[model samples]
Target chain A: GIQVEQSPPDLILQEGANSTLRCNFSDSVNNLQWFHQNPWGQLINLFYIPSGTKQNGRLSATTVATERYSLLYISSSQTTDSGVYFCAGTLQGAQKLVFGQGTRLTINP
Target chain B: EAGVVQSPRYKIIEKKQPVAFWCNPISGHNTLYWYLQNLGQGPELLIRYENEEAVDDSQLPKDRFSAERLKGVDSTLKIQPAELGDSAVYLCASSPGGGADTQYFGPGTRLTVL
Candidate 1:
């Protein structure tokens, strides 16, 4: 099993600020995704970047597969961004995803 | 179109009791998954279904946990004689069968066993 580690296990920011979170995996991955778990426990898919970069609204993510690391950026963060961010990955042809410990984010208004 | 749907958003029961949760995957999605998330932790895969067949269930606790996806559209997860440690949020997700499709998740059912 591959291990995934997320940096800054906890983070707090004032609304409208910006922040970046990083995830490092122990091995190469064929699938990588970033997810936001809201207070109500809904897991929202934020990005499906196994490699390269992608942006959606105020959130963006970049994955360097060769380096086995990924970074998620939140710009002009809102209070709604307060939750746990998780990075999950799977080896090539693996059907199950192994998850990181998660980064707890708190956005204050 | 409706996203993945899960029933019984919350449940509470005494230890040793039986509990079940239901899920309806997104239309036309051929891959369905069940995951359990402990407090402050990320979701862990319990089982994965490709249509009516379960392709991966290596992490599922065979002794007390069982799941079925009849017809491949809707699924159910059951826990008999549940223990307090079984308390967690159960999430269901669906995706089009492929290597690059993003998974759509349901709101999840929170179960509390006392």
Candidate 2:
């Protein structure tokens, strides 16, 4: 089983600030995903970046597969972004995913 | 189109009681998954179904947990005589078959085993 570690166990910021969350895995992975668990307990898919970079709205993510690390960027954060962010991944053909502890974010107005 | 649908937003029961949760995946989706998330933790895969067949369930605790996806559209998870440690949020997600596509998740069912 692979290991995933997320940095900045908790973060608090103003509504308009920006922040970056990181995830590091112990091995090469064929699938990597970032998810946001909202206050209502819905696990929303944020990104499925096994490698390279992707952007959606004010959020973006980059995965350096060779380095076994990934980064999620939240620009101009909003109140709705307050939640626990998790990163999960799996090796090729491995059906089970290894997840990081998660980073809890709180955005205040 | 509707996303994944799960029933019983919250449930509280005794440690030895039996509990079940239901999930309906998105229309036309062929892959279904069940995950467990403890408080302040990430979701961990418990089972994965491709159509009517369970392709992966290595992480599922077979002693008291069982799941079924009949007819490939809807699924159910059952935990009999659950333990206090079984308290967690159960999440259901669905995705199109094959490829590295995104998965859609439903609002999880929170269970509290006393």
TM-score of each: 0.97, 0.96
Q: Which pairs, if any, clash in model 1? A: none
iRMSD for each candidate structure, in the order shown: 1.7, 2.0
Regions more than 4 Å wrong, model 1: B98-100
Leading candidate by lDDT: 1
Docking class of 2: medium
Residue A85, candidate 2: Cα error in Å is 0.8
Clashing pairs in 2: none
Write down the lDDT of every candidate, Cα atoms only: 0.93, 0.91
**Chain A TM per prediction:** 0.97, 0.97
Retained true contacts (fraction), each candidate: 0.75, 0.78
List each candidate's DockQ score: 0.71, 0.68
Model 1 chain B lDDT-worst window of ten: B96-105
lDDT of 2: 0.91
lDDT of 1 by residue, A1-109 (tens): 8899999899999999999999999989878999998887788999999999999999999999999999999999999999999999998777578899999999999
For residues B1-114, what per-residue lDDT tens digits would candidate 2 score against the true structure?
Answer: 998999989999999999999999999999999999898888888999999998889889999999999999999999998899999999999999843367889998999999
Where does model 2 exceed 4 Å of error? none
Candidate 1 fraction of reference contacts recovered: 0.75
